[model samples]
Target: MSMAGDGREPLPHGPDPEVNHSSIGSTSPERDPLTSLMEIRGSLMVFATVMASVTYRAGLNPPGGFWTDNIDGHKAGTPVFQDVYCTRYKIFHYFNTSSFMMSLFILLFAIKASINNSDITKIMLHLTVLMDVITLIVSYIVGAYEDFQSSTYALVLMLMVFIYLVLEATTLIVRLCKAIRQMAYVLAKI
Candidate 1:
C-alpha cells in the first residue's frame, strides 16, 4: 500500500508499539489552581444573581395574589396564600427571604473580594452560596406543597444530594491537605 502525499500529519492508525499511549496527552501544562478558583467564583456569582432575582420576584408577587382590602383582619397587600395556608406560607416566605438575603450577601462578598483581592472573604462566600442553595430548595418545596408526593420526593432527593456533597467535599479537603503536607515535607528534604 502507498501512503497519500497529502501535506498533513498522518492520523494515528493504532497505538504505536514503541510508544506509551497513556501519556500521549500528558505534556500539556496543568490548569492553575487560581484559575479554577476564579471559575468557581464566577459560577457562584452567576448563581447568586439568578437566585436573588427569582426570590425578589417571588417576594414581590407572591402566589395566590394579595388581599385587596383591609377586611376581617387580613391586611391589604398581604399575600392571600399566607392567610389561607399560614404554615406553608410562612415556611415559604422565610426560606425565600433567607435565600434572597444569602444570595445578596454572596454577591456583595464576591464583588468585594474581586475588587480587593481578599482571600478571607472567600470562606464566607462559599458558606453563603451553600446556604442560598439550601434555602432556595426549601422555598421551592414549600411553595409547591400542594403536591405532597412530589414535595416528599424532592425533599428526599435534596437530602441525599446534600449528604453526598458534604461527604465528598470532606474527603476532597482531607486529600488536598495530605497532598499539600506531603509536598511541603518533600520540598523541605530538598
Candidate 2:
C-alpha cells in the first residue's frame, strides 16, 4: 500500500485490525487519562474546601439572643421578637451552615468519582450540591419571613433536595458497579 503525500494511508475496503484498536498516542496529550482524572479530582477538592469553610462559619456563628429585659415597672409586656431582624439572622445562619456542609460532602464524592473517570457520578454529585444550595436559600427566606407562602416554598425546596440526594446516591452505586465490572473483566483477561 502506497502512503499519500500527507503521510496518511488510505482506508481498507474491509474492517482493519489496526483500526479496531487504539495506539499509544492516538488521544490528545491534554486528554491523557491521568491528566484528565487529576484535573477533575483537583476541581472537586477545591469545591469541597470552599463549601466546608462556608459551613463552618455559618454553623459557628448563629444570630439572635434570648435575653430577658425589664419593661415598665414590675409589669412586663412580652413583645414578640421581630421576624425581620431576629428571625432573618437566625435563618441565614442556619441555612449557610447547612449548605456549606452539604456542599463539602458532595464535593468529596465528586472528587472520588473524578478519580475513577465516572462522569455520571460527578454530575450527580454536582446536581446534589446545587440542590442543597437551592434548599438552603429557600429555607432561609422562609425563616426570615413569617409567611405561610414562604414556608411552603421552603418545604418544597427541602423535598427537592432530598430527592436529588437519593438520585445522587443511586448514581454512586452505578459507578461502583461499573468499577467492579471493569476490574472483573481485566482480571479475566489476565
Candidate 3:
C-alpha cells in the first residue's frame, strides 16, 4: 500500500495501470511480420553495399571496374581502359571509392555507438547519415557527368547502381532516425 498523506486509510491493492515491463516503444503492437522482414532486408542491403564497395576498393574486382588504377603503388596490374591520364572518370572513381570506404567505417562506428547508447554515437550517426546523402549526391553527379566517358550500357548501369544505393541509404537513414526517436522517448520516460 502507498503512504497516505493523512494516514487515514491504506489504498486498495491492485495492479498499477502505468506499470510496464519494457521501455517505451519496446512493445510496439504495430510491428508486423512484413516490417520485420523489411528491416532484415535493409540490413542485408547495407551489408551488400559495404561488401561491394570494399571489394572494388581493395582492387579484387573485374577488369575495368573501380580498381583500374595504373600509377605506381596505386594498383598492381596495368590500367584497365588505358585512360590513366587522370580524367573525370579517374578522379570521380577515386573520390567515390574513398567516400564509400569511409562511409563503411562511420556506419560501423555508429552501430557500435548505438549499441552502447552513448551520446557521441548519436552525433556520429547523424554525421554518417549526412555523409551517406553526400555520397549519394556525388555518386549521381559522377554518373551523370562522368558516365558518358564510357559506353551507353556502362553509363546506364552506373546510374542504376547509384540510384539503388541512394534509395537504400535513404531508407536506412530513416530507420535509424526512428530508432533514435524511440531512444529519446525511452530516456524521457525514465
| Each prediction's whole-model lDDT (CA) | 0.73, 0.58, 0.53
Which is the better candidate, 1 or 3, if ranked by TM-score?
A: 1
TM-score of 2: 0.41
User: Which residue pairs show backbone clashes in model 3?
Assistant: none
TM-score of each candidate structure, all chains considered together: 0.60, 0.41, 0.38
TM-score of candidate 3 versus the correct structure, residues matched by position = 0.38
The candidate maximizing lDDT is 1
Ranking by TM-score: 1, 2, 3
Runs off by more than 4 Å, candidate 1: 1-34, 71-73, 113-124, 150-155, 162-190
Candidate maximizing TM-score: 1
lDDT of 2: 0.58
Q: What clash count goes with each model?
A: 0, 0, 0
**What is candidate 2's lDDT per residue for 39-139, written digit by digit as tens?**
55666677667767655654553333332456432222322332325555555665676677678776666556435545544455555566566656554
Error of 2 at 108 (Å): 8.6
Better of 1 and 2 by TM-score: 1
Across 57-112, the per-residue lDDT of candidate 3 in tens digits comes to 53344225444454555664544432443464455566556556666665455344
- The order by descending lDDT is 1, 2, 3
